[model samples]
Target: MPVEWVIDQIKAPDQSGAFSYASGAAPFCEIRLWPNRSLPARGFVFFIAATAVMLALPLIAVLGSPVWWGLLPFILGTLALTWFLLRKSYRDGAMEERLKLWSDRIEVTRIEPNQPETSWSANPYWLRLALHPNAGPVENYITLRGEDREIELGAFLSPDERTDLYNALESRLIAVQARK
Candidate 1:
C-alpha cells in the first residue's frame, strides 16, 4: 500500500511544556499517502535498454546499407520520445498527500509536482469523513468535510484502498476525539 504512517508516536511534553514534533502536543499522528509507482528507477533503466535493443535488432539486417541511415533517425527519435514520456510519467507520479492529526486539530496537505501545495485543517470535533460508493468521481471516493470546506482524500487510490482509508480515517478520528 502507498499509505504510510510517517509519525504515530505519543511523546510527552518537555519540562517546559513544549512538544517535540510540530506545533502540537503529545499523541500526534501523521499519515503520508501517494499513488503507486509500478516502475522503479532500475526497472525504468532496464525497460529503456530492452526497448533500445529491440529497436536496434531490426536494423542489424540493414547495417551496411543506405537504408539503415534512412531509418536510424526515426528509430532514435522513437526511443527519445519513449524516454521523454516515461520521465514525464515519473514526474507526475511524484505527488503526495500528508495528513496530520492532533488531539484538537486535523490537517491534510497535498503536494504535487510543479504545483502549489494545498492544505486543509479543522478541529477534530467538527471534521467528518464522507465515503461515496458510486456517486463520486471515483468509486469508493473519500472526502473530509471541515467547518468551512470539503476536501477529497486519496482520490488516486483504488476503490478498495479508498474504502480502507475511509475506515482507517474514521477510526483515527474516533481515537483523536477520545484523547480530549
Candidate 2:
C-alpha cells in the first residue's frame, strides 16, 4: 500500500527532523530521510581512462615478438583490478535512505551491496537527527544518524544541493525537537 502518511513538507537545515502528516489519516507512522552525494566526474573519467589503458597494454606489448603475448596476464590483471576499484567507488557514491518509527526499534539498510544492516532505537521523547561528515580524499558523504543507527545520505547530490539538504534537515530537526 502507498505510505499512509506522506511527508509533504520538510523543514530545512537540521540534519534530522519530523515529517508532518499530509493526509491526517494516521498518527505519525514513520520518518524517512535521504542524504545525497555526487560522484566526481573527474574521478569517473580517470577510472575509465585507466581501464582503457590497461585493456590496451596487451596489444601494445605484443607488437615486438611472440613472447610479447605473455603480457595478456598483466592486461587481465589490470582489468580486474580496475573493475574492483570502480565498483567500490560507485558504491561509495550511492546514497542511503532510512525509515523508522519512534515508538519501536529502527532498522537501517546500507543500500550498498555487501554492506551490513543496522538496528537501533531512540528515546521516544528526545529523538534527534545528526549528520556525520566524511572528508575522503576523493569524495565526501553525509551520514544521517537518529537514536540508534545512521545511514549515509547526499552521496549523489551536487554541492549546492547538499548544502540545501543539510539546511533543510537542520531546520526540521530543530522544529521537531522543540515540540516536546
Candidate 3:
C-alpha cells in the first residue's frame, strides 16, 4: 500500500492549553511528534558485557589445553552473531519513524532486511497506548494497542523524550476523544 505522511507539530501551551498540529497531505501519512526517548546506554553496556563473557569462555577454557584452536570457530561465530543482532536492532529502529492515523484507524510503517517496509493499522477510536515498564534495571517499552494488536515505539529515545512522547500521546488521545 502507499505510505501516508503525518506531521505532528507540538506547540507551546497557550491560554487554552498545549496544542499539537497533526497534519496529513495526499500520499503523505500522518505524523505525530512523539517524545523521542532513546534506549539507555546501560543496556548496550550490559549486552556488550554479556557478549564479552560468552566470547571469553572458549579462550579461558583453552588457556590450559591445546583447545586454543577452537577459539577460531567461536570467534568467527560470535562475530557473525553480533553483527546480525546489531544490524537487526538498527533496522528495527529505522522502521519506527512512520505512522498513520485515521478517524478509526492507526497504522505503523517500519523497515527490515528483506522487508524494507511493514504496515499495520487498527481502529483509532478504540485504540489505546500501553506503556510496559521494564523489569529490573532496563528501560520500558511504550506500546500502542488496538484490540489484539500492539506496536512498540520510542524504544531508542532518551528518558526525557519518552516522557514527552507519553505526555503527547495522552494529550492527543484526550483531544481525539473530546472531539467525539
Candidate 4:
C-alpha cells in the first residue's frame, strides 16, 4: 500500500484532557486515509534482476548455435511483454483515496494515475461507513453513504487493510458522535 500521508486535527488542547473524544473532530474533521501498495523499492530491483536472469538462461546455453538465433526473437518478445505488463499494473495501481471526517461534514478525495482528481462531501451527521466483508465484487468491500449517494473507499486496499480501515473509521465516527 502506497499510503501517502495523514493529517490529524485536534478539537482543542484543554478539551482533549477532559474527554476521551476531545478532538472537536465532530463539529470539525481531521482524518485522512490512503491506499496500500504491495511492491517496495528493494522488491522492484530484485524482481527485474530475477526476470532477466530467468529469461537469459536458455539463451546462454544456445550461444553460437543456429537455434539461438531462432529463439532470440521469441525470448526478447517474452521479456518485452513481461516488462510492459508489470509497468501497466504499476500504473493502474497508482490510485489513492483520502477521507476527511469533521463534525459537520465528511469529505473524500480520490486521485488516480490518468483521471482527474475528484472529491465528494456529505453532512457528518448523515455520513455512514459500511463494510461488506463478502458481498461485493472485491473482498472486504467498503463504502461510505452520504446524503444523496454512496461512494466506495479503500477499494485499492488489500482485504486486511480494508478491514483495518473500517475499524479506524468506525472509531473516529464514534468519537465524533460522543463529542456532539
Instruction: Find the candidate with the highest TM-score and give its number.
Output: 1
Rank by lDDT, highest first. Answer: 1, 4, 3, 2
Candidate 2: tens digits of C-alpha lDDT, residues 1-180? 111123423322232333323322322234344433244668767867877786886587567777666776777787778778877866764535454332222333334446665444444345444443446321434555556555555455555555555565555455454453
Candidate 1: the clashing residue pairs are: none
Q: Any runs in candidate 4 off by more than 4 Å, and if so which? A: 1-5, 9-35
| Candidate 4: Cα lDDT at 110 | 86
Estimate, for each residue in 86-130, the C-alpha lDDT of model 3 and write its tens digit: 656755544445665433346666654456566677665687876
lDDT of 4 by residue, 3-59 (tens): 433654433223433322234433334444555446665887788779878988999
Ranking by TM-score: 1, 4, 3, 2
Task: List the global CA lDDT of all models.
Answer: 0.84, 0.49, 0.56, 0.71
Per-residue CA lDDT of model 1 for 29-65, tens digit only, reads 7889999999999999999999999999989999999
lDDT, candidate 3, at 113: 49
The lDDT of model 4 is: 0.71
